[model samples]
Target: MQREDNFTFLTEEPIPKVIGTMAVPTIISMLISNLYNIVDTYFVGQIDTQATAAVGIVFSLMFFIQAFSFFFGNGSGNYISRQLGARNRESAEQMASTALGYTLIFSIVLVVLGLLFLDEISVILGSTPTILPYTRQYLGFSLLGTPFLMCTLCMNNQMRFQGYARYSMYGIIVGALLNCMLDPLFIFGLDMGIRGAAIATVIGQIVGFAVMFRMSLHKDIIHYTPRNFSHRWLFVKEIIAGGTPSISRQGLASIATIALNVSASQFGDAAIAAMSIVNRIVMFIFSVIIGLGQGYQPMCGFSYGARHYERVKAGFWFCVKVGTAFLLFWSVVLFAFSDRAIGLFRNDVDVISIGIPALRYQLLSFPFWSFMIMANMMMQTCRKTLQANILAASRQGLFFIPLILVLPHCFGLLGVEICQACSDFVSLLVTIPIVFSAFREMHV
Candidate 1:
């Protein structure tokens, strides 16, 4: 709980410079992490459509785990950053360590529960009869590492909050690189097949956790100690209250993904794989926006806590502008080379044929989608839980479920592909009024 170098060092600098410097590292970090996921699909795709679909199912399962991690990590780290901004480093460290401890315990329980009901959970996550074995094989191993993944997220959030984004980026970069290198070795050399991917993922996360731990001890300004470890009800409640929206957002997406996979399964294994690949590619693109938004988050949280409303507004708009421009550019690139992108994971003619329209439709909506993402993140950082939850739920949870079901049933495969983008459009329309009211209220 000692005072160290403060992030207010950048407060006097230009907002654009501060954001760009911080956001770029975080974006690269996400890109590196996403590239590993793409590599996972690429290697597993060689095994067969079932294997690839298993990867997709596992990804959704991971998203469900991430929902809780984000809820706790963001909740705790948001307040920690604000406390640090207010020069209360002791409370900041306490919050950081407590959240990390809570996440580790939660992860252990999740792994047990996940493995205990592996078959049922696998089925619920959209595993078809053919894909169930592969899903179980991979998820079974990966579930064991859930604690590492969750703790890693908590550590990364704390590092980011402490303004040590560079170290965080290194941890992720090293882990991703290791995962990519190990994928082929485990998949082919060791003859582990789809389960090999799971092993590599866990190994990569361990390496990440190690690096983050070192960064926490060596580079972090606010350090955790066992002496000041007593739990406080108010702090825990505050963390939950602040982070509830993120939980709702990620939790809803988990539900929606399960729904998408289930509905996609009805069309056949090819449809499922096609939709899965489409999701991976689109998610990679979305991660860039998310990474940038994450960089803005600590700043927004800190500034808002300090009552620097103008800085919060400035940071929000900066993210919006950068996010919109990047999303627009990526959308065009994805659209222009949609065929090449779809063909990267699989050579299945049916998958490529079905995926092209789906990819194009989803990518086309990225520009408008930026507004929803920015708004949601802004609300979350400012601790506007209800508004943030509503915004978070809009596209995936609320609008998407009905759209995915009704559209596919009515219009068939094309409708399934178009449903998400259609939901995104509606969400954007709904967001405009909310945005106006939010900005108006921000002044007060």
Candidate 2:
């Protein structure tokens, strides 16, 4: 009875309500997090166009940081969630501790190296002549906080595995609110400009880290302590094996951003800012679906672990319906307000003109992109690693890279704007067979 009670994915209730209960808090958390990013961009934009470009360039670096964090965080969380579902607390503790410890150590190393190579890193991220100074000021302080940043992600994921999404949401909410408040105060009240915006971000993240760590320290089914961690090669190997797909996904995203920045430089600084704004806006709108997909992941993982194939099928279909509806609604919102939306980030007439059309094109892909994302999430949760990796690689990986290269040559800037949406449409078509096949053999 106790084991059954602990197993959320084993619930025999209708899948929609069960998935909704789990997904709503997660969606709220992601939406708030996305709002913080938008706020970061908005406040920074007030400084200057150079400052805005700096935000975009530095964001690519942050994605690289998140890639490492997600690798360990998701890998560990996936295993731990299943263990907890099966009522095995000890193994969960070990995995949780190992992930936390590695994140801290890795974050420190990344921060030290990032600080040391600050200038070169900034240049490689495609900082323009005018944008370089502001980029340094923002990226430099942010590096010092990298350890906290990485640990925060691990803690958040660990908590989510424990089915404590509300606590995770609280930490992120407080952090976002703090950041939003400080952005205006630091930038305008203190007259500190770009550096102030960076400071605000660091301070806000520190608050989030503090809150998440506190929530994580409770006497739960899974706990994180250095003593419980293992130095065994197999444990590390397993974690890496499970996490490699995520590393490829997020790492490739970071690389793709760098490539995009380098490519856009030929067009000019406005091009970088314009595309950056478009990406941020797309991310903001997509957060709800991504959150719902994340909510579905643990359900899929635990159900697969227990061989509860019917529940897995139910949850998978539930997620697809929810994701489709949410994305479709937001796509309309974005399309209707794209011009005003892009203007919030910049006042440049040229930037707005290019950005509005690009933002619309990017958003047009979301309704279908939701299907691709949910499909990939389902594959990962079920440990269908090869399928997961392929799906993960499709959007910005194999498809986008080729499309990005070829389309620009063929159609110029409009090609760049429309390529991702076109690629997403094609990716969804490719995903149909795989998704349905998984559903067809839903019984374990």
Candidate 3:
């Protein structure tokens, strides 16, 4: 009876109300998570520019870890939602367990490899001589939390796709709030410096994992148990089909960060620190759109499975319109205060100068992301795998990768500042036709 209610809620609730109900908690969770990063950046910036830059350098590894977590989380979550929509509860349960099991095994391997190759990985992440020691300290401790972090994300996505986003939000909010509290205690009070920041983050991830794991045991939610774990070719294929877009999207983001750091390193530590701060700020602002798109995903998945195509289309347009308006407002406000915003993280003049224009330039293309992100999420959820993969790789991979390499060489510092904006514009152009084509097919 409870399960039937969930189906009715997803499939019959007015599109606006359904998305709003789902998006509010998701937006809050995303904001809290990004806020913790901002807070972490602020505390680290107090130490010195080098320490702040070290965190930037280590962001590549963090992105890599998140990429895999999303790979498992989105992959299984996508399948789970569709299964639930089709009233195949048994299959959804199996997928939940399998995703958790595989995520654990994969994250353990990453921990081992990351610990063994810490120095090499740090260097590969574009750590400069001045920043290498801080990078090593932070990355080493951060690696210890990889499994907990990865599994927490996996479970969070699973619960969200199950239409229990409030439970997912609770786990994330609790962890982020705890991390914010611990940051000052561990970093300044303990005098642990950057290492303290890393330790606090690890502890937060552990607590988040515990909370979400307990929540998963609730009778309403699907249970993940060892008894249901399976790696049969069929399940593997389904996970791959549903999850590859996320892997491409996040994996390329990791690679793009590495490229950006390497390119920025050519200038100096100040450049790296500046760009890093800009990335965090942008991510914080963009979290709203991501939350909206995530809210749309489960509805899209369930409706698509249940053959309610009109609801899926309505939800997509609703998200795009709302997201675009939100970004437009922020772009103008942030553009006016870019310098002040940049200065809040780091007081250095060079860092502020580089970050100000970068933030503004990116803002120019920010509104377009509403359409791009919503379209990609729609494609991914609807099992348009080929289109999803292409869009996923476009901004960061196909366009950004080459642009970062060439633009920096041609335009010097200015090129580095505007590369992401350029990539975003081109990606938007590429996405237009693909999205329209998908819409046409749905109508037919």
Candidate 4:
């Protein structure tokens, strides 16, 4: 009965209301998930600047983990939503189980490979001699939690795509809150330093995975059974089509972070630390818009599959307006308090000085992200894989990679400061035409 009602609610609810209902839980979940980093950065900062920088250095690995999780989650979730929209429960169940099966396999591989290459991976992630020990200590423990973290994130996306975002939020909130609570205990109370922080994170992820896995067994939600798992070419094609945009977006983000770190390393540890703080702050702000887009994704997938093109367009425009307004307000707030915001994570004078300009520059481009992100989400959900993949790659891959490489050489430290802002502007321009073309094709 609830499942039937969900279909009715998704299809028949007013656009704004439907999106609002969905967006709240998703926004909360995104915020909590980001707190894993924000909280870790804060607690670890208490030890010393190098410890904080170590967390930042290992952040790219976190991004790499998320890239694959999103690949499987978004791919399977999008397909599941479309199949559910078409009233095909069997197909949806199969995709869900298949995604879960592959997620576990891939995550185990990551853990083994990551642990085996721990030292090399640390160097590649831009860990300096001063930060290397802390990096290895923190990263090794984090790798152990890879399976739990990846599986939890994968299940979270699948649940949200099924319109069970509230249940998803419960699991994430529990984990994030546990991490927050344990951070002080492990980092300061136990005197374990950075190692404690890593332990807390792994424990939190393990618990979160347990909660979400239990939720997955609920009758209304699709259960992941062995019988439903498959490696058929048809399932693989669908997953790839649905998931590739996320891979491009998130995978490129990891690459972009590594590039930023390498460029900043030339200027010394202060530069790396400052830029790392700025990136975390920006990502926290950006997560709001991403959550808004996630809320709209299921609506887009269902409506598009059901041929309700008008609802898809309505949800897209609504999200863009709301998301842009939110960013506009926060950008101004952060710009005014740039020093304090950066200082909140690390109070070093060098870190604060370098972070202020970079944070402000990034904010200048924040308002434009709403349209760019929403458009990409819309295209991906509608199965415009090529356009979606192009848009996904534009910000971090196509534009940012080139600018980060060239600008720092030409302008020194200032180039690192403004590179992301420049990339955001160019990505927005590229997104405009692709989105327009997408809408015209839909006759919207």
Candidate 5:
């Protein structure tokens, strides 16, 4: 579609049609992006159980990188969407450029600080004596690609919010496919071990960033350049308000993972490895619902901005119903074969036993995500920062953090296993009324 028609479709097209067209590619893109890690884990799993634990341990730091990426990406993407919806193209481009520019600078700074204190950071991330060496090796290469990873995230969000999800998918898929191919080559073909996996990841990220950056140059998309960058107080406030939920979501996730690793460490490497595998598996599933929610989000922003509140309401409910049904079905499948699923990454008997039961507990609360994730996105897209931030933080930190901290200490490994499931159930109760009232207030 042409640039003008594409932007127009966000508000003018039938809501379901818009969502389906936009969401599928976005979903694919998300799954592919995640595949990079999954592929790494799969290959790393072959080495030994401890290597798998190392991968899992280092994931917390990676989440820290992702947190900042989402912060800038969503910060700028949300503002750009609203501006475009309001027919203010100049402001949209300016916000896009500013978010990317700021993200790049911050990421570079993080890389320097992170590399300087790599050993300390690894220990703090819950790496034990055995897993420490592999963790540092993997994290070192991953850090090299931090700037590009952040850039990829920022542009990916910007494209999706601009109603150009296909372009976003192309950029992401190109790099993900590259990573998949490079994984074996680097890890085994070149006999580099876990360090090879990290190198493949960095190379994939750089390629993805290049593709995404090139795509943004298209006239249909928002062009991000220094010339359009604005660091004004007004823009800063908007970015913070708009992106707070994303920051909360990704940031708290990092914290939750750190706590989970710390709590799991008390048991053994098996527990840490099991939880890591389970977490990745859960994220892969959750990313689908999130992608669908991403599909719904542009409609949410455009409809709310253009004052077509009924469309906003319609889009919200459509996502809730569809997301709920899928979660229900997938939960059953995951529950039925939890053993096989965890074994896919690590074949250790202990990891399998711990993961199978724990994964089922996590699956029990999967349906709640249909509600939690959609509501968070709707509120975020509509610029309800306070509610969105709380909802975002609730799942990843507020709820999960406390439970993981306390539950494991009391219940032992069982506490570590069920902590996330318990948190999800509580979050559902905490989340329902906030979102319902937000929807109740929407008017045409």
Candidate 6:
């Protein structure tokens, strides 16, 4: 809670400078983390389109995993940053410790259950007969690392929330580099194929978790430890309240992903493969937006708690402008290069045929998405949990799920292709009024 170090910088430094400094590291980390998936996809894509489709099927489950990580991680980290801003160091420490402890315990349960129900889970994830074996193989090994992945994710969020984005970057960069290096080796060098990709993924995640854990103990301003952990109902409620938006966001995204896969499956494996590739490419660019929003989150949390109302307003508007520019730049490029980009993954006429329109359609809505993401991140960090959850679930849950379900039935293949774009555009409409209203309240 001391204002002598990072806390001072977070609370008192020039808004642009502090946010820029925080954002760069976080942006790098997001790239590396997303790169993990890209590396896996690139390597696995070399195996076969079926391999790529298998990964697509498993992708929904990963969303399910991340939902929990963010639920607790964002929950605890958001609360911790606010507490630190208010100079309540003890509560922050307690929440940090308890969050990690709870995450570890629940992650073990997830891994065990995941392994036990591995086959059924694969089927539930929308794996086909041809893709089922690979899906099971990849998920079996990958699921074992759930604990580490959750820990790494939780720690990374905590580090960023506390303004230690550099430390977070280190852990992620190390793991991502390791994943990239090991991917070809294990998949091709050792001839393990999809299983190799999964093995490499687990090792990379564990190392990343280890690096973050060591840094959490030594390098970070706020640390998680056993002595500080307490299983209090109040803290649990707070974490769920603060993190509900993320859980809703990610959880609904998972459901939407599964729906997308199932809907696309009605067409063929090419549809699944095409949609997956577009998603990864788009998310790669979206990582920058997420990183920017993360950079803005701490400022929102710190400023809101410290009662620097105007700083919160300035930071929100600042990030929205920056996010829009970044997104718009990527949007134009991706829309223009949609064909070539989809071809990068699987050079098939069928895949490219399905992918091109989907990619361009999704990119069409990218500009408007920046506002919604920035607003959602700020609301959550500022502890406007109800509004945050509504906005969070709006894109994927309220808009996306129904759109994907109905659109395919209405327009068949084209419907599936345009579902996400439709969702994003609709979300923008819903978000603008809510966010601007929140902004209006800040002035009062």
Best by lDDT: 4
lDDT of 4 by residue, 239-300 (tens): 89999999899999999999999899998898898988998899998988999999999888
Better of 1 and 3 by lDDT: 3
Q: Which of the predicted structures, 3 or 5, would earn the higher lDDT when compared with the native? A: 3
Give the RMSD in angstroms, all C-alphas superposed, for model 6.
1.3
TM-scores, one per candidate: 0.96, 0.95, 0.99, 0.99, 0.98, 0.98
Worst 10 residues of 2 by lDDT: 2-11
Per-residue error for 344 in candidate 5, Å, reads 1.1
Clashing residue pairs in candidate 5 (N, C-alpha, C atoms within 3 angstroms): none
lDDT of every model, 2 decimals: 0.83, 0.79, 0.91, 0.92, 0.88, 0.89
TM-score of 4: 0.99
Expressed as tens digits, the lDDT of each residue in 297-416 for candidate 5 is 877787787888888888888988998999999999998889899999999999999999899999999988988998888888888999999999998789899898899779988998
| Residue 273 Cα positional deviation in candidate 1, in Å, after optimal superposition | 0.4
* Predicted structure 2, TM vs. truth: 0.95
Residue-by-residue lDDT tens digits, candidate 1, 318-346: 88888899888988899999888988999
| Tens digits of per-residue lDDT for model 3, 1-444 | 888998999999999989998898889988987766788899999999999999888887898898889889999999999999999999999999998899999999999999999999999999998899999999999999889888998998999999988888877888888999999999999999999999999899889889889888889999888999997877788788888999888899889999999999999999999999999999898889989999988899899889998888889999999999999999999999999999999999999989998999999999999999998889988889999999999989999999999999999999999999999999999999999899888851
What is every candidate's alpha-carbon RMSD to the true fold? 1.7, 1.8, 0.9, 0.9, 1.1, 1.3
Looking at candidate 5, what is the lDDT of residue 372? 93
Candidate number that wins on lDDT, 2 or 6: 6
Off by over 4 Å in 6: 1-3
Q: Tell me the lDDT of model 5 at 100.
A: 90
